[model samples]
Target: MSRARSVRSPRPLLGAATVVAAVATAGSLFLSLGLGLTPCRLCWYQRILMYPLVVVVGVAAIEERSGVARTVLPLSVFGLALAAYHSWLQVTQTTCSVGVVSCATVQYRLFGLLTIPNLSLLAFLLVTGIVAVASWRTRR
Candidate 1:
């Protein structure tokens, strides 16, 4: 007698979100390193949060572990908050002080509208939403 494999993996949504988070993290790195753009204080804070998320969620999703949500939840929420604040600072034009790196600097703009912070904020929001929904669905 042979043991059978399961029909499908159960955590597709989580897996996808984790992959997207990884992609987002890579994109941020590309913007900073490849494009020669420097990150400000808030950007550094956000990067600190986002970088780990890629690894934590990626491993959890690959293992189909239930504890993934518990680990990711607080990170996602805090990341979202940081992204939002960064975006707000960018929008308000009150980013840099006398000796600080300008958080409001729009290093690059796509279509003259989207900036670095904007992109970061958007990515965080999407990831957070996906994680929240996926966690809620899985718990049911």
Candidate 2:
């Protein structure tokens, strides 16, 4: 009789999530600083939720700490929700008048469809899913 064991490392999964967050953070900064795109209220909220994730998630991945799930999940989930709402506002042409620029204003779009909020939504979803899987693997 032979016994078989499956070995899985959560570090890779967390690392992927860290990369996602880092890219998203950099992209957002580039859009604002490089391109001079003004961030709306919702965009600012999403940024607030996402920016810290780079440090938090990156540290967790580097330290190989699965406990990061507790922090990452909440922030990512909130960011996802904000991004979704922002996307909806843009799609519906509803302007959220909170800052200098309207939230519904689409400064630019990729492929004439993908907006900034869309990218934010995707990034949050990826980080959320990856961190969740890493946490699950750690538990199992």
Candidate 3:
């Protein structure tokens, strides 16, 4: 008599990142479209960095490819930096010497503390953390 061995595959990190990215994307979209909020230049830059992540991670997850996680690090790092800078701009307000839709504009605030850029910063940090964890685990 022979016993069959069951195989267990590790969870794909990309899937986890993809789920988070999806939620982030949807949330931002809702805030902009549903709430009729205009995104400033900084906000648009953050969106540019985040929007592709949703598709990239989602595809990698569907294909069960871990390489993408490692590859996405640069983007995540830059995104984190941009989000941080954008958040700082809102806090400092620097007189916003520019015209309309200045980067320092904070359209709405959650709990009177978390501005849109602050939320973006949080989201980028989350993505960066998740991607780093996934990459580290994949190597181990």
Best by the TM-score measure: 2
Task: Put down candidate 3 lDDT per residue, 1-140, tens digits, no spaces.
Answer: 22221111113566677777787788889998999987777777778889899888777667656567666778778888998988888788765644458888778888988988888888788878877776565556
Instruction: Tell me the tens digit of each residue's lDDT in model 1 across 1-140.
Output: 22222223326766777777888788888987899888888888878878888888777777866457778778777878888877787788865762357987767886899887777777778767776676666556
Model 1's alpha-carbon lDDT is 0.75
Candidate 3: give its CA RMSD in angstroms. 3.9
| Global fold similarity of model 3 (TM-score) | 0.84
Instruction: State the displacement of the C-alpha of residue 22, model 1, in Å, after optimal TM-score superposition.
Output: 1.3
Which residue pairs show collisions in model 2?
Answer: none
lDDT of 2 by residue, 1-140 (tens): 22222245677888899899999999999999999998888899999999999999889988888889999999999999989988999989867777888989998797888899999999999999999998887788
Give lDDT for model 3: 0.75
Pairs with steric clashes in candidate 1? none
Residue 81 displacement (Å), model 2: 0.5
lDDT of 1 at 52: 88
TM per candidate comes to: 0.84, 0.92, 0.84
